[model samples]
Target: MYYIGIDLGTSAVKLLLMDEKGTVHKVVSKEYPICFPHPGWSEQSPEDWYAQSIEGIRELTADCEKEMVAGIGCGGQMHGLVALDDQDRVIRPAILWNDGRTAKQTEDLNQRIGKETLSKYTANIAFAGFTAPKLLWMREEEPENFARIEKIMLPKDYLSYCLSGVHCTDYSDASGTLLLDVEHKCWSREMLEICGVSEKQLPKLYESYEVVGTLKPELARGLGLSADVKIVAGAGDNAAAAVGTGTVGDGKCNISLGTSGTIFISSRKFGVDAHNALHSFAHADGHYHLMGCMLSAAACNKWWMEEILKTEDYAGEQAGIHKLGENQVFYLPYLMGERSPHNDPDARACFIGMSMDTGREEMTQAVLEGVAFALRDSLEVAKSLGIHLERTKICGGGAKSALWKRIIANVMNLKVDVIASEEGPGLGGAILAAVGCGEFADVEEAAAKLVRVVDTVEPEPELAAKYEERYAKFRKLYPALKETF
Candidate 1:
C-alpha cells in the first residue's frame, strides 16, 4: 500500500508519495499567493490551498498505481482562522499564523480576562498569532462576517474537509487554537464563551493518526485514486516535524530552524510551564509535547543576505564567516516580533555592539549566532521545568548549514543529530498516514523503523564555554531592550 502526505504550508502545498516501506516515491509542490491587506496582517485563500493541493496530488501520483494509495494525511500551518458559511463556502481569506493584526485583541484577552485565568482555561496565554484572538478580532471588527460563520477550521482542516468531506481536526492542531483545554484534551467551555462562539462551530477533534474518513468520490476520481482512500487526521506543522524526526518517546527532542524556530520535546506525561513560556500541546504520537517557538529563524539570515546585503548567494556570504564566538557584534533575532518566552509582538530586530572595525563576515556570523542564542532561551525555560535535554534532532532549511548546526550545538551544549532525510512535516504526515493504514503497528514502531540519523554534531567544551559567556550577554540584551521594544 502507498500513503500520501499533504503539507499545507504558508506559501505552497507540498504532496509526498510514500510506499509501505517508507521510501519516498515522488514529491510535488504547488505555490500560491499570500496576501497582506494591512501591515502585520497575512491571509491566504482557502480555495487556493484546495486547488493547489489537488493539482499537486495529481502530479505526485501521476506515475504510480493510484489504486495502491491506501491513505492520505495532512500536516499544516497551525492557528490560521478559516471560517465557512452556512453553505460551506469559505467566508473569507484565512488569517495566517504569521499574521500579527491581533495585537490589540491578544492584549485585551491577557488583560481583561487575566493571564492566569486564560492559562487556567487553555494552558496558554493569548498571543497575536493564536486562532482565538484572530476570531475575536474578526468578531469585533467584522461582525457581519463573524455572524455568518458556521464552521471554524484550521488551515489543513479546510483541506481535509475538501478531501474527505469531514469537518475534523487533529488534537495536535487544535491545541494551538487557544480554544482547547489542552491539559484535558477537550474544548474549553470558558474559552468558547469568551470568544462568543459555541462548540458546534468547531470541528470534531481526533488523535493525529486516527482515520477521519475516506476521500470524497469526486476528489478521488479527479486524482485517479480510489474512493476508499482513507484520510487521517494529521498534526500541526511542529508536531508533524517532530514525528518525521522520530521524536516520539519520552525525553526525545527535535529542533526546527525554518522561518520559525521550535524546540520540541516529547514526553509520556503532560506538563505545562508555570509561566506558560512553552506551549503544552498534544503530540502526534498520542501523548504530549512541549514546544517553544521563535517567530524568526532562517528568515533573519535571509533578510540580512538578501534584503539588506543585496545578494542571493547565501552560501557565499556564509563562507566568509569563520570566527564563531569570537565576534564582538551581537544580533537579536526578533524581526517579526517574538513568541515563546517573550511573547512581545512589539519587539524589533536589532544589531547591537557593532564597531567601525566590524566586518561583513562578523555581522553575518552574528545573525546565525543570534538565532542560536534565542533558541537557547527557550531551552533555558525547559530546563527550569526540569526537562533536561542532552541532544536534539535538527531539521529545516537553516539546518542545511554545517556552520549553523555547529553553532546551535555549541550554544545549547547538546549533540545535534542530523537526520538522513530532512523533509520535516510532509514526511511526518505520510508516516501518520502509513500508521493509520496499518502499515506499522504504532507511531513508535513506525518512527523507530523509518527515521535514521546520518550524523551527529558534538559540542566541544572550549566552544561551549565561549558560547556560554556569549549567551549570558545575549540574554541580557533582550531585557535591556524590553522597555523600548
Candidate 2:
C-alpha cells in the first residue's frame, strides 16, 4: 500500500507519496503568500493551505495508483494560531510561528502569571510565538475576532481537520501551544482558563501516529483516492523531522537547520530545564523530548545571500569561505528575535568585529558560524540537565551545506550524521502514516526500518578548540546588546 505525507510549511505545502517500504514515489510543492500587516507580524490564509494541499496531493499522486494510498499524515509548522468561527470558517489569517507581535503578551505570561506556574501547567514558559500568547494578543488587539472564535487550531491541525473532518491534534504539535500539560499528555485547565478559552474550544488530542479519522469522502473522491484512507494525527515539524531522522530512542538527537534552527533531544523520561529554556514536549514516539529553537538559522544565510548580496548563488558565495574558525567577524543570528534559552523577542541580528579588512567572505562565514554558535548555546543548556549526547542526526535546507555541517560538528564538538533523505517533515509524515496503517508496529519500528544514516561529519580536535574560543566570544555579545535591542 502507499502512504502520503503532507508538510504544511510556512511558505508552502509539500506533498509526498511513499509505499509501505518507505520508498518515496513522488513529491510536489505548492507555494502560498505570507502576509505581514505590520513589522514583526506574520500571517497566512488557512484557505490557501487547504487549497494548495489538495492541489499538491492531486499532483503528487498523478502518476501513481491513488487507490493504493492507505494513509495520510501531516507534519506542519508549529504554534500558528488558526481560529475558526461557529460556521467552521477561518476567523482571521493565522498568526504564524515566526510572528513576534505577542512580546507584550509573552512578557505578561512569563512575569505576571509567573514562569514557574506556567511551566507547572504546560512544561514550558510562554514565548512570543506560542499559541497562548497569540490568544492573548487576539483578545487585546482584535476583540471582535477573538469573540467569534469557536475553535482554536494549530497550523497543521487545521489541515488535518480539513481533510479528515475531525477537529484533532497530536501531542507533539499540541505541546507548542502552551495549552497542553505535556507531562500528562492532556490540555491544562489552568492554561485554558488563562487563555480565556474553554476545553471545547480546543481540538481533541491524539498521539502523533494514531489514526484520527479517514479522509473525507468528498475530498477522497475529488482526488480520485479511496475514502477509507486513514488520516494519522501527525507531529509538529521539529518532532516530525526527529521521527524522519530516526531520532526516536532515548538520548538520540537531531539538529534541524531550516528557516529556524533547532537541537532536538529525544528522551524516554520527561525532563525540563531549570530556566525552562528548552521545551519539554511529548515526542511522536509516545515518549518525551527537549527542543531548543532559534528564530534564525539558514534564514540568516538566505537573507545575506539574497537580500543583502543580491545573488542566489549560495554555493558560489560559500566557495570563498575557507577559514573555518579563524574569522574576526561575528554575527548574532537573531533576525526574528530568539526563542530557546533567551526567549527574548526584542533581540535583533547584528554583525560585530567587522573592520576595513573584512569583506564579503568574512561576513558570510560569520552568519554561518553565528547560527552554529546559537545552536551550541542550546546544546549547553541540554548539557546542564546532564543529557549528554556525542552525535546528532542532521536535516533541513542548511544541512545540505558540507561547510556548515563541519562548522556545526566542530562548534558543538559532536558528530553530525547525515541521513539518506533530507525530506524532514514530509518523509516523517509518511512514516507516521505507515505506522498508523499498521505497516509497522509503532513509530520507532517504522523509523528504525525506514531511516538510514549515510554519512557522518566528525569534529576535529584542533578545529573544535578554535570554535570553542570563538563561541565564548559569541556568547558575550548577546548579553551586552540585550539592552540595545
Candidate 3:
C-alpha cells in the first residue's frame, strides 16, 4: 500500500508519496505567499494551504497507483493560530510562528501570570509566537473576530480537519499551543481560562501515529484515492523530523538547521527545566522531548550571501571560509528575534569585534559560528537537566553544508550523524501514516527500519577547545545588548 505525507510549511506545502517498504515514489512542492501587513508580523490564508495541498497531492501521485494509497498524514508548522467560525470558515489569516506581534500578550503571561505557574500548567512559558498569546492578541486587537471563534486549530490540524472532517490534533503539535498539560497528555483547563478559550474550542488530541479519521469521501473521490484512507494525527515539524532521522527513545538527539535552528532531545520520562528555556513537549514517538528553537539560523547566512553580497552562490561564499573557530569577529544570529534560552523578541542581530582588517570571510565565518554557539546555549540547558548527549542526527537545508556540519560538530562537541535521506518532516509524516496503517508496530519501529546513517562528523579536540572559548564570549554579547534592543 502507498502513503502520503504532507509537510505544511511556512512558505509552501510539500507532498510526498511512499510505499510500505520506505521507498519514496514522488515528491511535489507548491509555494504560497506569506503576508506581512506590519513589520515583525506574518500571516497566511488557510484557504491557500488547503488548495495547494490538494493540487500538490494530485501532481505527486499522478503517474502512480492512487487506489493503492492506504493512508495520509501531515507534519506542519507549529503554533500558527487558525480560528474557525461556527460555519467552519476561517475567521482570519493565520498568525504564523514567525509573527512577533504578541509582545504585550507574551509579557502579561510571563509576568502577571508568572512563568512558574504557566510552566506548572502547560510545561512551557509564553513566547510571542505561541498560539495562546495570539489568541490574547486577537481578543484585545480584534474583539469582533474573537467573539466568533468556534474552534482554534494549529496550522496542520486545519488541513487534517479538512481532509477527515474531524477536528483533531496530536499531542506533539498541541504541546506548542501552551494549552496542553503535556505531562498528563491533556488540555490544561487553567490555560484555557487564561486565554479566554473553552474546552469546546480545542480539537480532540491524539498521539502522532493514531488514526484520527478517514479521508472525506468527496476529497478522496476528487483526488482519486480510497474513501477509507486513514488520516493519522500527525506531528509538529521538529518532532516529525526527529522521527524521520531515528532520533527516538531516551538520550537520542536531532539538530535541525533550517530557516530556524533547533536542538531536539527525546526522553522516555517527562522533564522540564527550571527556567523553562527548553520546551518540554510530547514526542511523535509517544514519549517526551525537550526542544530549543532559534528564530534565525541558516537565514542569517542567506541574508549575508544573497542580500548583502548580491550573490546566490552559497557554496562559493562558504568555500572561502576555511578556518574554523579561529575568527576574531563575532555575530549574533538574532535576525528574526530569538527564542530558546534568551526568549527575547527584541534581540537583534549584529557583528562585534570587527576591525579595519575584517574581511567578508571573517564575517561569513562569524555568521556560521554564531549559529553554532547559540545552538550550544540550548544544549547547555539540556545538560543542566542531567541529559548528556554525545551525538546527534542532523537534518535540513543547512545540513547540506560540510563546513557548517563540521562547525556544529566541534562547537557543540558532539558527533554529527548524516542520514542517507534528509527528507525531514515529509518522510516522518509518511512513517507515521505507515505505522497508523499497521505496516509497522509503532513509530520507533518504523523509524528504525527507514532511517539510515551514512556518515559521521566527529569533533576535533583542538577545534572544540577553540570554539569553547569563543562560545563563552558569544554568550555574553546578548545580555550586554538586551537593554539597547
Candidate 4:
C-alpha cells in the first residue's frame, strides 16, 4: 500500500506519494497567492488552498498506481484563522501565522488577561500571530464576521475537512491556536470564552497519528481515488517536519530554516519555560516539545538575494563569504517582526556596523550569520532551562547551503546532522498516514526504519570561540534597538 502526504504551506501546497517501503514515488507542488491588504497584515484564501491541494494531489499521483494509495495526511502552516459560516463558507481571508496586525489584541491578552494566566492555560503567552489574537481582532474590527463564525480551523485542518467531510484537527496543529490546553491535550475552555468562541465551534481534536475519517465518495471518485482512503489527523508543519526528520523521543532536536526558522526540542514530559519565551506544545509522537520560532529565517535570505540583490545565484554570492564570524556588519533577521523569545511584532530588520569598505560579500555574510545568531537566541533559552543540546538535525532550503550550515554549526556550537531525505512536512505527513494505516506499528518505528542521517557538520573550536564573542555583541543590539522598532 501507498500513502499520500500533503504539506499545506504558506506559498505552496506540496504533495508526496510514498510506498510502504518509504520510497517517495512522485512529488508535486501547487502555489497560491498571498495578499497583504494592509501594512503588518497577511491573508490568504482557504478556497484557493483547497483548489491547489486537490490539483497538486492529482498531479502527484498522476503516474502512480492510484489504487495502492491507502491514506492521506496533512502537515500544514499553523496559526492561520480560517472561519466558516453556517453554510460552511469561508467568512474571511485567513489571517496567517506571520501576520502582525494583532499587536493590540496580543498585548491586551498578555497584559489584561495576564501572561501568567495564559501560560497556565495554553503553556504560551499570546502572540500577534496566534489564532486567538486574530480571533480577538476579528471580533473587535469585524463583528459581523465574528458573529458568523460557526466553525474555526487552522490552515491545513481546513484542507482535511474538505477531504474527509469531517471537521477535525490534531493536537500538534491546535497548539499554536492559543486555544488548546497543551498539557492536557484538549481545548482550553477559558481561552475559548476569552476569544468569544464556544467549544462547539472548534474542530474535534485528535493525536496526529489517529485516523479522522475517510475520503468522501463523490470527491474520491472525482479524483480517481478510493472512498475508503483514510484521512489521518495531521500535525502542524513543524511537528510534521520533526516526524519527517526522526526527531522524536526525549531530548531530540531539529532545526528548520525555511521561510521561518525553528529549533524544535522533543521531550517526554510536559514543561514550560518560566519566561514563556518558547512554545510548549504537543508533539505528533504522543509526547511534548518546545519550539522557538523566528518569523524570518530563509525569508531574510530570500529577501536579500531576490528582492534586494535581484539575483538567483545564491551559491555564487555565498562563495565569496570566506570570513565566518569576524565580519563587522550585522543584520537583524526580523523581516516579519519576530516570534519565540522576543515575540515583538514591531521589530524590524536592521544592518549595523557597516564600514565604507564593507563589500557585498561581507554584508551577505552578515545576513547568514545574523539568522544563525537569532536561532541561537531560542537555543539559549532552552539551554537556560537546562535542556542542553549538543547537536540538532538540520533541514529546509537554508540547510542546503554549506556555508550557512557551517555558520550555524559554529555559531550555535553544535553538530549539524543532514538527513538523506529532506522532504520536510510532506514526508512527515506520509509517515503519519503510513502509521495510521498500519504500515508500521507507530511513528517512532516508522521513523527509525525510514529516516537516515547522511552527514554531520561538526563545529570548529576556534571558529566557535569567535562566533561566541560575536554572538555576545549581536545579543546587545536587539535590546538597544527595541524602542526604535
Q: What is the lDDT of residue 484 in candidate 1?
A: 91
Backbone-clash count (model 1): 0
Model 3, stretches more than 4 Å misplaced? none
55-172 per-residue lDDT for model 3 (tens digits): 9989998898888999998999999999999999999999999899999999999999999999999999999889999999999999999999999999999999999999999999
Per-residue alpha-carbon lDDT of model 2 for 97-183, expressed as tens digits?
999999999999999999999999999999999999999999999999999999999989999999999999999999999999999
lDDT tens digits, residue span 268-314, model 4: 89999999999999999999999999999999999999998999999
Q: Using Cα atoms with residue i matched to residue i, what is each candidate's TM-score against the true structure?
A: 0.98, 0.99, 0.98, 0.99
Error of 4 at 375 (Å): 0.5
Against the hidden true structure, what lDDT does model 2 obtain?
0.93
Whole-model lDDT, candidate 4? 0.93
Candidate 1's C-alpha lDDT? 0.92
lDDT, residue 425, model 1:
88
TM-score computed on alpha carbons, candidate 3: 0.98
lDDT of each: 0.92, 0.93, 0.93, 0.93
Q: Kindly report which residue stretches of model 1 are placed more than 4 angstroms away from their true locations once superposed.
A: none
